[model samples]
Target: MKIAIAGAGALGSRFGFMLQQAGNDVTLIDGWKDHVEAIRRNGLNVTINDKTFNVKIPTKYPSEVTADMKMDLIIVFTKSMQLDDMLQNIQAIITDQTSILCLLNGIGHEDIIEKYASKQNIFLGNTMWTASLVGPGHTQSFGDGSISLQNLVDGHASEAKYLAACLSEAGLNAEYTDNIHYSIYRKACVNGTMNGLCTLLDADMAAVGATRMAHKIVTTIVNEFAAVAKHENIDLDTNEIIEHVESCYDPKTIGHHYPSMHQDLIKNHRYTEIDYINGAISRKGQKYGIATPYCDFLTELIHCKEDIVLKNDPVIN
Candidate 1:
């Protein structure tokens, strides 16, 4: 399969390297000049299981993108705020046969893709893998993971299976799921609770679990999210959800990892998917008459702080 990874940051670079190693033709597309230049000069450095390996693949800046090369699949891993512009940048390469899969962590991305790509060629997926860009052209792999995917509401089963098989052939653990929406929400809940708290408290995954109040705070957020999930006709167990969140902190698991929200806030970026995660819960809570004061306050606080930071010192252009 000829694959193009749009937004080749940490996760995208990792996937591109792994797929390329599995003998699939992969190209990485990004606007980060340093990363693209470094990868072009010396291959992408992938660190997994405390070891580093170099994988050579073509990398290109967005401005260099052309329509000459046909892509069977394009994985969208851009930050939620960057998705629209990323889609616009890739218009020349997308065709009727192109499959665009979004592995981003938020709601409303499907609508954005539907506006640009044909519904028949779009797929939605959720991933549990954690990654970070340790430096330019260097990606740190934090955990062993799998992917769960499905076609959009207006899609066909055959397409989902075909795409899943392609990813599986590329050595990515991919599977078709009937309940991808629930899976998305489940992950959202986990991130909403863990990511925000870790960022606000300056804690690592394991350290977050070590504190006495950590479990209670996560329980509060997850239970509130479960209330919203129930209204959407999805059944979830709070205990099971707690276990899933706790597993992230296990020493044997991805223990030393810091959540993306933590990294974003440290970089003083204006956007965080708090609006999609906790903000989504708070929005649904209003409709169901469920009070999610914790999520509400946290979402508002972060937004206000980010607004101040961006206003004072706008992101480097």
Candidate 2:
């Protein structure tokens, strides 16, 4: 299989290295000049379970990409805010047979992807996998994660099965699902609580979980997300989602980690995906006449943080 990782950031680097090790022809496409140059000069550095090594793989910037570079699959891991621009820049490599699998976090991504690729060639999915960008061309990942995906259009079961098998071969724990929308919503509920609250409080998952008010905050956010999901005809088990999210608070698990949103706003001084996560829910809630005050407030607060961080930065300003 010839694959291209469109974002090639933290998670994208992890997937690209694994796929390349599985004997697939994988090339990383990213916009980060320093990261791309580092990988091209030296191999990508990957640390898993305390052991670190480098893997050599091809990488290119979106502008440097040409039509001659054909791809069997393009896995999109770009930030939610960068999805549209990435798709627009990569149009030349998408052929009739090329399939696009979006593992991006958040909701409503397919609508943007379908503009460039056919619905039949698009796949929607989510993962519990986590990765950190230690530095340029370097990433650290641990623990186990599973992928659940489905075809965006009906009657593409064979294609979905093939892609799942390929990823599973690379130790990615992939599975095909008939209800990926439900899976996406379930994951969004998890992100809505951990990502939003952790960013607002400037705390790690365990810190947020340890607070006396943790349960109340989680319950309130979960209820709002559940209401919006139901209005959209996506059934979500509120209690189950809450339990799963709370389990991440264990110090042994992802409790020590700051989510991507926190990393974006605080560390990188960049924008966040709040608009696609909680903000998307708030928008839909308005359409369905369901009020989502918690989601609405969280969205506004993240944007405020972005304003403060970006405006204060000399380079960004």
Candidate 3:
């Protein structure tokens, strides 16, 4: 398959490298100049379970991509805020037959993606995979993650199945489902708690889990998310979601990891996906006359942190 990994950051690089290693034709599209240059010049450096290696894969800036360079599939991993811009820049590569699998973290991405591609050609899912961008061309990935996806529009299950099979063949642990919305919401709950709280407290997942208030904080956030999910008609088991999130708190899992939001706002001084995760929930709660005080507070706190970081960093506008 001719595949392109848009956003080629941490998770993107991991997927691209794995697929490439599996003998698939894969290319990475990213906006970061240094990262792209490093990958092109020195290959992609990946560290998995303390083992390091380089994988040479083709990469391009979105602007450098042309219509002739069409892809059979485009796996989107861009940050939620960058979704629309990435789609706009990569327009030339999307065709009627091209399918887009958006495995981005957060909600409301399919809405933006549909503007550039046919609804029938879009796929939605969430991954348990975790990766960290250690530097321009280096990424640290560990733990096995599974991907759950579904067709965005009816009558396209075959395409989704094909893509899922391909990813699974490449060791991505992918599965297709009819109810990907539930999975998306479930993952959002995980992010809404871990991502936001970790950033606010400046701690990793395990540290937050170790805190005395861990259960209270996690339960409150999950409850708010469940209420909103119920309003959306997605059946979310509050207990199941909480259990899944708590499992992630184990140091054997992703406990030692700082979530993407923490890496974005605190480390890189970039804006977070709070608006898409917790902020999305808060907005939906308002629409349905549901109260989401916890989500609302987390959203505000993350934005306030962004403001503080940006204010001190003269380099970032």
Candidate 4:
């Protein structure tokens, strides 16, 4: 399979390296100049379970993509805000048969991708995989993860299955899902609660859970998300979701981990996906005449932090 990992940051580099390791012809596309250069020179440094391998996969700057380049699949891992620009930059490689899969954290990403790729050729997926950027061309991944995917257009079931198989072949456990919208919402809920709170409080999941009022705060935020999701016909179980979310607080689970938003805003000094997560809920709440004070307030707080960070130490990449 000819694959492209668009927005080749931490998670992107991990998948690209693995696909290449599995003998698939994979190219990584990113806006980060240093990362592209690093991979072009020394290949992508991937360390899994403390085992490191420098897999040589071709890396390209999005602007470097030409009409001659074609891909069977393009997995998008860009930040929510950068999704549009990345799609525009890599339009040349998207042919009629090309499948664009978005594994971005948050919701409402497929709407933006539809402008660049046909709905029938698009796939929606979410993963439990985690990756950390060690440097420009290196990534550290831990444990195991699974992918849930479904075609946006129903007629392409065979094609969707093939793409899922491709991911599985690369050791990325991929499963075809019937209700990808629900999966997307489920994944977004995790980010909305854990990632946002982690970034805002400048703490890990355990620290957040340790607070006496953690359940109240978390329930407040998730209820807002649930109210908005209800308007869209997604009957999210607030209690079930709350239980699932709070499980991250266990030290044995993911309690020590700071989420992607923390990596983006707090550590990297980059803007976060707050608007896509809580902000999206807030916006939808207003649209549907629902009150979402928690989501609204969290969105503002995260943006304020992003502004403060950007003013202090702006990120270059």
Best by lDDT: 3
Candidate 1, residue 231: how far the Cα is off, in Å = 2.4
The candidate with the higher lDDT, 2 or 4, is: 2
Model 2 stretches with alpha carbons more than 4 Å out = none
RMSD to the true structure for each prediction, in A, is 2.0, 1.0, 0.9, 1.7
Ranking by TM-score, best first? Answer: 3, 2, 4, 1
Candidate 1's residue-wise lDDT over 106-203, tens digit each?
66689889877899888999888888778889989865898999998554878899888888876789999999888888888778878888777778
Query: What are the runs in model 3 whose C-alpha is more than 4 Å off?
Result: none
RMSD of candidate 1 to the truth, in angstroms, is 2.0
Clashes of each: 0, 0, 0, 0
lDDT of 2: 0.91
Per-residue lDDT tens digits for candidate 4, residues 1-317, read 89999989888898888888898898899987877899889888999867999877888888899988899989999999999999999999999989999999988898999999999999999998888787889988767788999999888878878889989998999989888888788778788888988888999889999999889988888888888877888888888888988988887656777788998778767788898998998888888999999888889999888777788563442
TM-score of each: 0.93, 0.98, 0.98, 0.95
Pairs that collide, model 2 = none
Residue 262 of candidate 2: its Cα lDDT?
84
Which stretch of 10 consecutive residues in model 3 shows the poorest summed lDDT? 308-317
Q: Model 1: what TM-score?
A: 0.93
